[model samples]
Target: MRYFLTLYILAIVTLIGVAGFRGDISRKPPIEVFPDMDRQMKLRPQEPNAVFGNERSSQPYVEGTIFRGMPYQDTPINTGRISGTTNWVETNPIELTVERMKRGQQRYNIHCLPCHGASGDGKGITSKYGMVAVANFHDARLVSMTDGEIFNTITHGKNLMGSYGANINIEDRWAVIGYVRALQRSRLATLDEVPEAMKAALEKE
Candidate 1:
């Protein structure tokens, strides 16, 4: 009975020490067994922060920082391949349209035309410089590659070609790809595929 009474008293003391007397105002902060990061130092935008010399929480963008809704997401749209797999996506993720095609054409002219040529026939000005290694898009090997494979090539660069990933943003890279597809289609499109008006005019020739 004596031991039980002593243990009961100790328990009561422990409970009070841990939780404090009910309704009693305590000067000390409450003990948190599991803090769960309830309180933490954080930098708020536009707030005064001593960490930076300017005393501004806001900071300039770091070089090469690409803005993304989900910075770590692994999707075909971002990676040019199916998420969690090594296989390349079979087609461009961006919707094909005249505007997108025009954007692609513009970017391609700026970047790819130097080597791949205006016609994408591997006859760009670099040919005159004795640079014979540039790839011709119409070749059977290149034509057979999937869109994702081509995107990977554009992003990382294939043999002899340097990576354009740094120069081209993700969406623009896909745009350039869409333009390349149009170029490829230009070579293989059947007369039946031509617009009726254009077909009639061609037939007149």
Candidate 2:
């Protein structure tokens, strides 16, 4: 009974010792019951290390390592051009579908409509803010460019334009290309190119 009472007193005193200490400043390291790999021995990036000759802790990526989620199988789809050649892909690799066009329209409006306008006429809202030299899709030079060239331009950027690659993904880029084509065709359409049903509606108007 005496030993148990003494143990209880000791426990109470220990608890008091732990709980009584509270302050804004702490000089001791934090108590971690579970370290959880927090203090790894591995050297941090750019840390001086003798293992590498230059003492850099970082190393180059493994040879032939393709980055995650980066596509390399379809050259034309991934890069918008054939391998080892400057020839641009004449047509979009993805099939034209209503859903795809809708998505393309959505992407274009978000990323491109600010500069290219709704009709791709180079008179977008940015023009009102003193931006000049926006390219018109209806222009003969742009119309003559193949799908691949346009995709490359979008990926790498052209004069006075920045690359949209970081802003859009691979598939979305193709969709935007398709939508741009539609915009161009609409602006340059002739009576013969219009479908007969549409032509009837147009003639009525």
Best candidate, lDDT = 1
Residue-level lDDT tens digits of model 1 in 50-160 = 988888999899998878754547899888789999899988898978898999999999999999999899999988998897999999887878889988888889888
Worst 10 residues of 1 by lDDT: 64-73
Candidate 1 lDDT (Cα, 0 to 1): 0.89
The TM-score measured for candidate 2 stands at 0.64
Candidate 2: residue 110 lDDT (0-100):
96
Cα deviation at 41, candidate 2, in Å, is 10
TM-scores of the models, in the given order? Answer: 0.65, 0.64
Candidate 2's C-alpha lDDT?
0.88
Clashing residue pairs in candidate 2, if any?
none
lDDT of 2 by residue, 1-205 (tens): 9999999999989986765566645666767776877676888887788998877889888898888987566579888878666578898998879999999999999999999999999989999999899999999999989999999888889998899999899889999999999999887778888888789988877
What's each prediction's clash count? 0, 0
Q: How many clashing pairs in candidate 2?
A: 0
